[model samples]
Target: MKKLLTAILIFISLFFFAQSRPEIGGNFIKSLFTDHNAEKAHTYFDSFVGSQISVNDLKELYPQIQGQMGNFKSILEVNNEKDTYYFYSDFEKSKLDIQITFNAENKIIGFYFIPHKTFDKADDKTALKIKSDDIELKGTLLQPTQGDQKKLVIFVHGSGPQDRDETIGENKPFKDIAEYLLKNGISSYRYDKRTYSNPETFNNQSTVEQETIIDAVNVAKYFKANESFKGYQIIILGHSQGAYVMPKIAEKAQVSKYIFMAGNARPLQEILIDQFEYIHKIEPSKISVEDIQNIKKQVEFLNSKKFSLDSPTSELPMGLSATYWKYLLDYKPLEAVKSIKTPMLFVQGGRDYQVTEKDFNLWKNQLKSNKSAEFKLYPSLNHLFIKGSGTPSPKDYEGKGNVDEIFLKDLVQFILK
Candidate 1:
């Protein structure tokens, strides 16, 4: 998806103005995607947006999403909330929630594609809320129909503003994992990240602690205090970014065990550089040499003393503020893991470029002295723990794929054992 994928996490810095006309907003969105016209779409973007995103970026992103969701049908409805226009659009394969943020001049400044809200509740699933102080997060709890609810897996989201399902394009990895676990008599809970459920509180100055750990700690505490789950083992499972913060969550909560699914042991700044390099190697056309150098410069600047809380967010990678980078830079994941005595499992997908074998190896090697640490590696799976062949690129995240059965079996065994 070119730089668009890179810019997916980029924080918008502009002060937005409201637009009352859905027809005008609808027409702009139609022209942008109807023919997959990147050039035409680029014309609508705010001038400041040109630096971080390019027409080529839009060109690369459209096809990747379309490949997953199929061709766009039409905007079924539109809702304008202040500065953002939310379009409920129909695609061949699914309905999508399309959002566009406008500048004071009514030019497009931010664009995002989110899955339409669908609480696919069955008899085994029940809706719930996890309360943490003033913030309340909506969540889902799945209980096995035939077994004792003596154990519950608390799912912590990887990164970004993810829904409870952890929906990525057409794939819902968290939902798939939870549903499969229920079939095996395991209970689980998954919730929307604070950034997703309450963005105003999250703001742009959030750290990994505020973004992930606190909510996770609260979820664990909430369940641990519940009378129904008395004597039950509360296990926390972290995927991707969740893995990075798992140890801290475990330290603050009364969890029996923790899981690392494609977790990273390195700092996020380093991982960002590694990911950009990996993408550039596999799909050179999508990420240019200049793009690589630019990212490196941002990372380097972030590491330098010149970076302070007052530094411009626009100059930083992903437009994240200095506070966010500083928190991650100071976070020693290895040190964090070593401090926790709780039994842990490290699961890695060999094909996952985002959190590669290099990261898994770090966890295994460093924790080798800890008998409480266990490991599993699946050679054919991608970041989502889904199987794939050939070189895995950003394209792997597109389309439909379920978490591998073998991996799930092993996960269930670990939880039960």
Candidate 2:
């Protein structure tokens, strides 16, 4: 998901630049992929980057595009014909559409790309201004087209920074869900987490309970006061880490129901360990048992305030940060959700290595033992609940697809029934 964020940010930045670039931005992109002289390519791109941006910035997001994308010979085929193509050039596929259109001046005027049906059409968001405790939170209000004010849903994004759309991997999961729900007449509210645009306020921080919990509370408070949704019982839809945090938020916010999409049912540490093990099995792998054990040692190294973000690469594995690993392990979802009173719908995807079948089954047992939980598994779906096959990888998500059809059907049923 982080990988996808980098790509989307780069794509968005390029899209914005394509509008007013003094030099043809399309040509710049083409040169980036096709040019053989790494130095010249690097220099050309550096010359155009805005003053506020650093050369190292794009490097973090698109090192793969600049360094590795142009290396491979890729094949494109239709019927009996075989066509060879390189990426970064404009092209079309059944799912992905990309192009650069021109104006009279021959400068790149409109660069367009569309990813089709990227997620479920969530119900439409109603516009509402939610006021709370000297803070005004922007709310994307959703209303069911058919149902009475008895049912509504709210969406909260996963860990890391997220907008209302839960933007990741170059896909807008929340937008897709919002669009889908509108068609089905299910209402929803997805808002920006307090952590965003206010990171400095949380920089020194307090107990790091899920920040989205605050969002969940605020949205619930919105539901409480809004005349349009006066009689409805609010449901919270949380994805990934949001799932971990939602139960507490639901209880505190006084919501009546909750949904967990691609959620985990185990301790975060165990899940992270599982994720590492899954990715370690990939060819040209970056994870190993030795690395895992070394990472464990670094926990002590980090917690004692001895770790440095700038530690030499020789001290640790490539791209592994002690500070980040230490921080991630602290979240405890299983503990948070236990004994929660609200009804729940737990959705899991088969191909999702980020959160596995094991975690799903644990949730199944926990929910089954209780009268309030319902479970559904999509065997071919990935971490995003998108219909998928085989192992989950960075490449799989690049191809366009919607969230699982079964998940959509279940969502409609959950609200309707």
Candidate 3:
């Protein structure tokens, strides 16, 4: 829950690539009506992509998407820190809303086809509701049936304000993980992120410090003390941004091993820059020189501790705060990882959107500093550790896919041993 968590509207899954051709007089641009120019949507977003037109140019030739998508739709937003253009399409009373993110130059980084059901609106039957930390967080706990002295695993989700199941598309990833682990005689706890759980409570507020890793830390401690978890070793499995917080949680929990799931290996600033640079390439044509310059200034301003509180950067996107940026910049997980001699297992999804190969490599580099680090990457897996490639999308889960069997097997073996 970044400072302004309540402002966003979530939906949709379709993604697209921008720019049909190389440059100025490309045949694709000349014939914009053709399907060849329109192109089939891509599943994953690529950074360093060139655009037919950069997103900045859109202000010059803007056609509001609001009439079609509804109010509160953003024509441009951030991906890793670069401004990307997004289009929303809500059709015929269907619950699904399609939101596509673009680069500052206006190329498509990816799309989120948000499923219709919101957490508040979702039926309770779909979730195993629980309360913790004096906040009524929604989540499901998996119990190992007929098992004695069961160890505990806690599930933590990434950057977004996500529900307990870590729901995306038609999939509830945490629920899937919980059920699978339970079937294998392991007990697990999964909970909705505070960002999503109590967005209104934090309405119009939150810089980076307001949300992020600390919630997961609190959640871990809450369950570890539960009567049901009386005699178990608490192991944490933090995926994506959750991974960013895992080491901290492990430090606080003083528990067993930790599962690093799709965590950011680089500093938050570096990752954000990389994400933006990637989008810059795709829509090179759509961007204006002035806009790029402004973005650069903004990123630099964001990274600066000397930045003024009154700066315009504070109002961007989710209103990401300077304090939050400072905190993230100051957060060094490896030091925490190094500090703890706890046994560690690393899980990397090969086709993740935000976490790239470089990120995993960085993790490897840092963790190797600790000889006790255990690492495994599933080449076919996406950010969620479910399998996919070419552009991982939520649809991957809706039709068919399983979290890598080996990842789970190895995890279970590690815990059991």
Candidate 4:
């Protein structure tokens, strides 16, 4: 459900300047949005920048930036690497890294807003590839070195272009889960999402079948065919959006079990609206009423059955095509679950704003007749199954944390039992 924001704006002089003050940088950024006062902002620019870049230059640039990132909200975090400081600024739409260096007078001498990157670690894992047709995704297979491996978990990522670790800010929940499972003698296989690896292959027309399901089915088949993995029970673990589509994947892939992590029983459109409303309630300024109305109009169109292939993608919610929405409209998770005979473990974070307790309850209620269906509720955890307290927001994900230990212990029990 997370989207990546990218920007690269750099203006640096050949010579190095003095240490930059975070307050100056923060205020200057605030000025850009407050009044768009290029003339005033120019005064904070160092001599080198002032000479080369005029007020008109900033005027032209500020509008372009606001068009993409919306109004600047606040500076979330600042990291210093020697003379350079990277300010993780939160905008209305997304977060960006503002790299700046100040002159001796504390004026802005060098500045940049580059793409954010958080490095992944996988020393204990073996690199592999999961291929299907033209798509070949880079992946990792981790096996416990100490104990007998009788099972392998295949991780399916949530919506968006996710890397192998399902990285969010500094957190790598999948990697953390993989390592924890490895310690307990459980092997895991995770790969970059198709949209992440081969973005060119997808467009607005692409549905979940193309973006997620096929690749996951292929991964299960790949492992099942391997001689080494012959007798091991293959468990498919789907997170968030992945969890919503787990039943479809389970139908195609002959996995022994399914693990739905923060999965939703409600339709995606409903869940999306709920997420926006929750964000607006907690932080009224972050999501505007106009935004909610716009999304609702799109949701109404999808439910109305008036849209066809001719419908514009721009008018659709999340810019997904009419075909994509149609697919979701036709397929119901609850109905899909009825056909899934494979044992399922539905887990949800009590504090998860994205997929809340309502969705979990829907799953529990709908699947109550099924003896094989199990459920877990981590009351203190967030969407990522990471521990946190108080009101949950996007800021909650910024802090570094791992999946709850208790959930992992229970997962092991479910798998081994």
Q: Write the per-residue lDDT of candidate 4 for residues 27-59, one digit (tens) a residue.
A: 677776677888888888878889998888889
Off by over 4 Å in 1: 1-70, 73-95, 99-112, 118-125
lDDT of 2: 0.60
Encode model 1's per-residue lDDT on 1-417: one tens digit a residue.
Answer: 878765654533222233344755676677667877778778778898866799899888878877767888899877666888778887877677888888777787888887654443444348887798678878999887798557899999988888898887668889999998888888899998888767788755778888899999999999998998888899999999999888788778858999999999987878989988988998998888898898899988988988888888877897888888878878788887898788899999999999999999999998999999999999999999999999999888766789999999998888988
RMSD of 3: 15.0
Winner by lDDT between candidate 3 and candidate 1: 1
The candidate that achieves the highest TM-score relative to the unseen native structure: 1
The Cα local distance difference test for each model comes to: 0.84, 0.60, 0.59, 0.84
Q: Model 3 over residues 43-71: C-alpha lDDT tens digits?
A: 12244432544434333222243232223
Which residue pairs clash within candidate 1?
none
Clashing pairs in 4: none
Winner on lDDT (1 vs 2): 1
Worst 10 residues of 3 by lDDT: 20-29
**TM-score of predicted model 4?**
0.74
TM-score of 1: 0.79
* Candidate 1 lDDT for residue 396: 85
For residue 164, what is the lDDT in candidate 1?
Answer: 91
lDDT of 2 by residue, 1-417 (tens): 999999999997777556543334434444433443333334333332323334454344244543422232222211110121112332322222223443443333333332211111235335455654445555576665574446778887787656677655445677788778777767777766555524444432322353556657777877877797777777788898788666667667777778888777675556655666666777335778776776556444544565565554345332344444444456555665766776788888888888888888877776567877888888888888877676687666565576765688888787666
